[model samples]
Target: MTRTGSPAGVLSIKPFRRLWIALSLSSFGDWLSILALTALAGSLTKGSAENYAIGGVLVAKLLPALIFGPLAGAVADRFDRRITMVVADIMRFALFLSIPLVGRLDWLYIATFLIEVVTLFWIPAKEATVPNLVPKDQLERANQISLTSTYGSAPVAAATFSVLALISKVLFSQPQQQANLALYINAVTFLVSAATIFSLREIPKQRGKVSVPSILKQIVAGWKFVGSTPLVRGLTIGILGAFAAGGAVIGIAKVYVKQLGGGDAAYGVVFGMVFVGMAAGMFLAPRILQEFSRRRLFGLGIIGAGVALALIGIIPNLVIVALLTALCGAGAGIAWVIGYTLIGLEVEDSVRGRTWAFLQSLVRVVLLLVVASVPFIAGVVGNHRLHLPGKNIYRFDGPNAVLLIAAVVAVIVGLVAYRHMDDRRGIPLIRDFVAALRGEHYTLEESTREHGVFIALEGGEGAGKTTQARLLSIWLRDQGFDVVMTREPGSTKMGMRLRALLLDKESSGLSSRAETLLYAADRAQHVAEVIQPALRRGAIVVTDRYIDSSLAYQGSGRELKVGEIAEVNRWATNGLVPDLTIILDVPSDIGLTRFASPADRIESEPREFHERVRRGFRALADAEPHRYLVIDGTQSQPDITRKIHDRVRAILPDPVPPSAEDETSTMPAIRD
Candidate 1:
């Protein structure tokens, strides 16, 4: 399951290695600076004035994400992304170093705001670099490693901050001044982050002229693309929801903690709980994804957090509240990995930075809004205006009202997430195994055989087969056959990813033919992982096309010879072939006419090349007559389906119908 670049997986790139090291150093520096600032704030001001100032500084830090996330995103897309981070880090470095010299309250706010703005660019710049670093299959692991940095840093930093604050308190009368020196150390980290970015070397950028209109258009275009892609949209929204609630909970945590029992010491214990909980949550994420029923982890995280926070607010006991805080913390950590992993998987390289920035900005905005509402809510509860159903209305002195609110929202959101979304693993290990090995994932009902035969459609583009497969799958399901349906470059995780790259019109002329091996690699996983298993369990599996598509597209379309594709694919699956392949035959013109926009990467290939791919698929079908049934796709939908059903019935004899089943010409109030 771990896909780090090595003998087994593909994400370990040289540039990624350097970037990871740089990121670790940057994270360490970030921790050091934060501790320094917290200590300084603790000692600098005499009373409540200092807390307000500290809070103000914290608000300022969050502003960049709210105010300039889009602007930063635009810059990353239009210019060198690596340079963007370098510049952001450099900017922060200079500001932090200057902090000690200024030593005034005003300087603190200025430094905080500037550091935040720098973060706006830094986050997107680093996130955008991920896809280029490794193969899609390893993205989850890459994200895990990236996330582990924050999780790993938090616990260590908490301890470090406590120790450093103690030392500062002992050494200087003006302890804030002693902590002030730590800002210089933070500055050094920023410098190192910038230098490390500078060392990343050149990476390819999107090819085209960059203009104001183009940049704006590109940003809008990215959003449009997101809206249009259901997979992308569903996952993004789920992530956004979880992040928003997590933000509000974090905002209200202080009040919730103080009420529990500990005073100032409670801060470390609670934060430590969060760090530990989230790290543990993050660690569980991959396993849950691998083994559980499908659902988005991000949304799950949100719901988990929401429920946890609400419990903290309602639970009065400090120990339980601490545990709840940990739950909330863990949710936040898991959500980050899932959301970032989604972004890395879905977007293209050219606009990757902008897309990342857009998402960063989006989450930041959500966080900012949640944070801003905290004190206001506290005031309301304090004034006796706020109340929730079946629970006490928390007073505004602290975070209880807000924490309760977050918890309720989390449960609602978690339910929504579970009900709507499906799990998207990096690899659909179990389903793929079932499909490939011909086994039933769930218990097969005895009566299912009397209804429909499950069949999956698979094939290459321009093979004129998707419609045929769809028609066949429907006809089979409708003929009192219990049909479950799917297609390939697949409905599964590994398959969907390959499909995005393979059929993407915008990706034309970019992917290497040798890279067809990746497509084949995905298929091998699909087959050994998906197809045969379904067949073994009495599923009369009918596919539009299966391994045949890779053999055609990667083999002939990319010129990797059909046999080599077969061999590697064979190695991938031990030579598993589909029980039946219904290849929809088409003259190149008829097939070409089917694509109205011709906007996809693969579909836009030169005419002769497509013609050859068309020929290649036909030949593959012809070569495997026992498995492949060539059909005329130019026929009407009903006619095509009829032909497919005919082939299915010819191969798999129907099971005995129930006594009244055949006699029931009645509508039976059943909608198929």
Candidate 2:
């Protein structure tokens, strides 16, 4: 949820990095196989039957998902994920190798079907295992990388297929032989994938009882959850619709290319461009659109893709078609990434596998129907010519007409999904979009802090923040304000231990990053256990030393990047920002002199460190004047107390009159 960091940060995890490598190799093979199989299918049939044969091959690849999708997730849930992935990869390698060796159309479909069945199990296991591989905060980044690897290799595969095709033409006597080289190479990639997966010991093994009924129950529960959750429902519909349009394009791409007077290479470029666009979109989306509502963005992405698809249907030039295909890919890619991220963030881990499986199953079924039917529809419509007055002829073909219809359907689905799941329904779409572009949008979920007020006192060590927080809470309580006074690093039970570890001089050897993480851990537990509950019940919660302490101390004082520190704390607190932050400004030497006891680990830092911390606090206040107050810490105690009281009064609830309090003296207090 933190928008302060890059998605590439997850790649630093070794296990995930290795898994990403394996996925890349496997995806390369899958893309190459698609090209080889479709080309071979076209070669084996005549003009009219070519479309059907290609559709049949594609259908064979998707059909297993309908039968094995839920079962695959169950298997992933009930078995060892590492073993499942390795076994699936090995089977796929054998099946792929057999495709080239058999040299029969029936064998081709059979092998493709078997490969897809293996893939069904592989995909769920991978998706389920990914959440366990990285920190919860890094899951989105991990998905971005994994998905990018999944499709980013398509361009490379297309180029490889083209090169292999030329090699076969020079090396063989028959057109059927042209695809053999690519298929054989594809088989090798799977073997490499299997080896990579087999070596990964990090993937957790599933434990506990498992059975057919349990699996079925889980599947049913997943579906029920999907239906009940508007976010999931919209994501499901949007993703399926997007893929349906994509499948239609894939089904007729070969024939469409032929109609444009293009050969296999042209088709390969067209295919490659789509994924190129996908990779670009996935890479750019998080960076550029982080401010937008993710739910709304998912729908908009689908709509954008549909518009691009419609343009593709109307455009005549192959170059233009390729460009539009890339644009379509970009929109779909954004939707795809956002959809998966939302699921991971919102769905419980216990049911995540089944949820993913249910969605995958539905998506595959939709793709199969669209892919199988679109090419046939194109063939039926064939080509038509209409004469105009000035010897001009307009041609309307099946591919064009089918694409146009699919585009319209996709657009409608996007609109419905957007409206159904829109979190910012009342906010104007254009206004929110413009704000997002300016990077000033409030991207957090609507705040539940309506009834309560949150205030934090932050400053360098020994700057009297604790004293000020105490005085302010006392003042608010005297005025009949429900005030909860707390301090981070010691507010809750868990935070107390962290506070001891952090402030003890004996722990001086702790690394700066470790110290920062410890503070964040304390703050997270404090917010969840102490602060949030008090705030929810309409209390004016006053906290001493919140997020700004970390940003100032670990970030600037320890010379760590402020943005990185902010990102960690933002996720830790679930984007909970205090309504007001008061910084008691004082010079480091003067502030340190106020401490009577032996200096703690942080307080004992050199003058330069504390100076940097002070500067950090001032900089933060300067940047957000509306949310911050900087008071001179050297002021008289009563003057400082009065200054804090004046600011606190602005956010406090209306004070109860003496007459009203006397009238309700015997009655039970009704709190919001």
Candidate 3:
């Protein structure tokens, strides 16, 4: 799906529609049951059954996943998952609609089991669909936007359904009984889900072995594939751990109302809050994935989930529980996203079928186990009818304790797995920091520097850096070099806001490190957009201040570590270094004299700080003899321009005039 071209062209793909429709419809129905299902079960049976049946039916439904998962996975792998998804939805439609008709408990049990059979295949098919729909490198963003659409729509639809159910309850004799509307509505969603699946055009299907040579062999093969890949195996194990604990938390959430506080309705809030967390996680995931390794993010998500789960047992307040549940949801959402992202990245298009199938099977089996463990754990937790310990009987009331146990285990395993993920660990750490500089190295080297140069005018507060940048731009253009000069911490949208905060005299108590970071973030955008393109087009790329400003001013003047600023700049530019640095050596008093207005925030720094900044610049210049050219900042504007022009000529012969035959060399490739 790496359809690399103009980004707008990629949105035209049809598979996106199918992905959107399926998630929206499925989640909407899932939400209705989220609050209603417990009520439905409670009405159908006595108190014991109400308690056990919810857990029981879930267990029963999930059981087939343990037995039939491999076979279903094989089917999804062998045949067209599109057809499988379509058929599965149709089956769910029939079963959900028919579930309302099943008069006996046995029939209901059978229906529950049957629906999960459909789910076993459906989950994997849906999971595998995204990479097919979007290009490879864009997968993270595509996945992000896709998940956002799903999560964003689900809540709106759920709220609509909740209101509908509430209104129907007032009109109906038995509001609990009328919850069947949700079942029928869910059934319709399945129908809609199926229609969306069917609407997509044919994709190249992956083939799987249908010959029943050995079921054990295929199962073994699936396991082998999972085990062979470091990424898949580690993440799958982590995912299983996360879900197992998460399911426990969900299963016991209703018990919190009975023992702690709130009821089945409270359970709804917990889940709804969790979903809200999903929306938030989807929004922030790109940053996490970009700045941090996938494994680290995955670990953090799990660790957060586990910690929240543990906290629920320790601090058992409804409000706190709600907050933690939301946290748990957010963590889970992040974990889920990372899982999807990793799967898409690790698995090839052809083997994606088997990979997702295997993944889905594992999830189904784990869910079933989570469901099965509930009653047994509940039985163990309750005050014994047969003299079992109260700890054993309290499983329903204290599920988080068990969840906490799971969380602790997950954290330990994740920490170990974290050590093995080597692809990203160190590179991005430095890359982000380097990117914070005004004009990074990549912006310089990649630019065909024959006709253009990126002269980043940089100095302390009231240093006349901006004026010099403009002056240099004018001089360079007159000399026949096309010049582009821009300022740091204000070039891009967020950067401008950051620039205001950094330079504002009124914004007191700003941390030096915070100031340093803001400068880095702004440089990231300028390099990506302004500097790189200009240089690439053979134009002179000049900036007001490059990374050196941060190193000299923030790093040395403000006493922040140069290393830390370097790290931030590195990440921002992907480790790009500037081709040359021309340090404007000016006494702090002379620099201040250049500004007619009162000193802005940073300009008001102590004279000692300004001295350190000037010294820091000179120190950097000394370290890199060839790259840095120091010019007297105290010189008149004309003399200053002449000196800067000489430095430009020394780097590369000054550009020919526009009227000259070589004018084409300075033509701007960049557009506003």
Candidate 4:
């Protein structure tokens, strides 16, 4: 079944639905356990000892990921994922149930560590299972839903803990008893998660043996692959950087709030707002910035977070700081979703588990280091009140300095990752981002309509688009179909005049925008008078030099905004985009060398201009790969023709046979 690229699509699969529910319950229970374990730790200690006990429990939760992550991932890959998850959940259920029954601080810490170790194994298995359960296009939506469920359940768990505390006070009359009840309830959630997973028999078993040497080899191979692949390496670094930024914020949030003249209540509000922003960014950013590349978006998200964090350090107002915190969280959310989606899409299944494990472990370690050191670093930095001229005072504190440093580090890391991972190299990032915001990026679906297939040929000067179009037209006619052979800028009576004006040497001084409009006007006339009419009649309309040529020459070559040029052309053509655009890619020097006669006004431009035009054509082709056929113009003419013909044949409808009467009456003779 074809799945829609929406949240509903993933939910439509029964096994995925069950798995998703299990994940939600498990995550909710995990958070509840954290609160319960901390409360238990406090009960077992007094004075300053309570703080250490609570910190130790939290640190214990993170430490196991560093130690057991690779081994857990190897086990996940070598055994049945369904059994792994179920067994892990069962162990967690028993261990969590014992945490309260045993009632010792050491036992509580040990149980927490064991729970995290079991969770490490469960996580990689679950992460590896998700992609197999959904369609490729729907992976992002699935991840979005999973992340929403994972993080979204935190507030509910917190609220549930609060309510359970109230009920325990009223019924049991002891704080320890209340904490123990919450623990018991959390253990039961694991049991429920286990039962849910047990019902999902669709989870696949491991393909290979689970020997020690094999596990070690797989782990090494996974690390080598991550180090070798540029995209994965960039993703890993960007993800870790994002986590580090978030960790710094979390680690210093309390002190930062205090510096802003706020207390625990204010800190809670800011913390909640961060998650709110995260939810907004994940749920809304993709929809708003639909046309932007995910690679660019991910990098931009990190940069945005860094910028927001820097702004927070400079601003002393608690309200502004809270808003900035939310903004930072939103950016982190976008990066998180895009990064995980890329991993699932780009990484192969063989090493997917290990890759996920490595990512998880690295994130945990970075977070651990950041959390462990930020407080110490803040203490060493100390606080100072700076006096400036004109009665101005700036109070600089440890939290502010830490945040400033984090912001710089995050921005630098983001830039490095962007340089490595950006797919659309050479295009300005700021310009693309602005264009995306202005709604100028065009989607293929928006440009195409249900009609006869329209094919366009595009290239630099003298790349033989006219020849290719003619050959394609004749081939279509020979196959017993009606074919409309045409060219833009001259196909219509009005277009001829505009084309002449555009090409004449006298128009050499025309402004770039004027030249762009002239080309768009010619396209408008050509499409209205010829292309759309033929397409509506179900004829194959093969055109030479369509919208792309204008985009290349007037936009890229002339250095005008491609998005603005595209918008004008889109309006002029009334959204009649070609079904297929075959870009005959040729080097500028080679293409220019083919024009032996005196150059036309546009062709007489510098070699640099022509090179830009050539690159522009290639860039447009790269952007919409499925709609384009980019062939080397230096290839043999017959080979090029054959390639075009094969592609056209795949999409062409069955040919209609000629009528008997029409066949009999075809006796017209040529009069010379």
Residue-level error in angstroms, candidate 4, position 503? 33
Clashing pairs in 4: none
lDDT tens digits, residues 12-105, model 1?
5777777877788788777666556544554456533443444555577777555575676666677777777888888988888877777777
Which stretches of model 3 miss by more than 4 angstroms? 1-23, 43-51, 66-91, 101-104, 118-161, 168-178, 191-219, 225-233, 257-264, 288-294, 343-356, 383-396, 422-672
The better candidate by lDDT, 1 or 3, is 3
Model 4 C-alpha lDDT versus the unseen true structure? 0.77
- Each prediction's TM-score against the native? 0.55, 0.60, 0.53, 0.57
Task: Determine which window of 10 residues in candidate 4 has minimal summed lDDT.
Answer: 207-216
lDDT of 4 by residue, 487-515 (tens): 87788889889889998999867999898
RMSD of 4: 13.9
Per-residue lDDT, model 1, residue 595, is 66
TM-score between candidate 3 and the true structure: 0.53
* Candidate 1 minimal-lDDT segment of 10 residues: 1-10
Highest-lDDT candidate = 2
lDDT of model 4 at position 457: 92
Worst 10 residues of 2 by lDDT: 207-216
Stretches > 4 Å off in candidate 1? 1-19, 31-54, 65-94, 97-103, 118-152, 166-185, 191-233, 254-269, 272-275, 296-298, 316-319, 333-357, 383-396, 422-446, 449-672
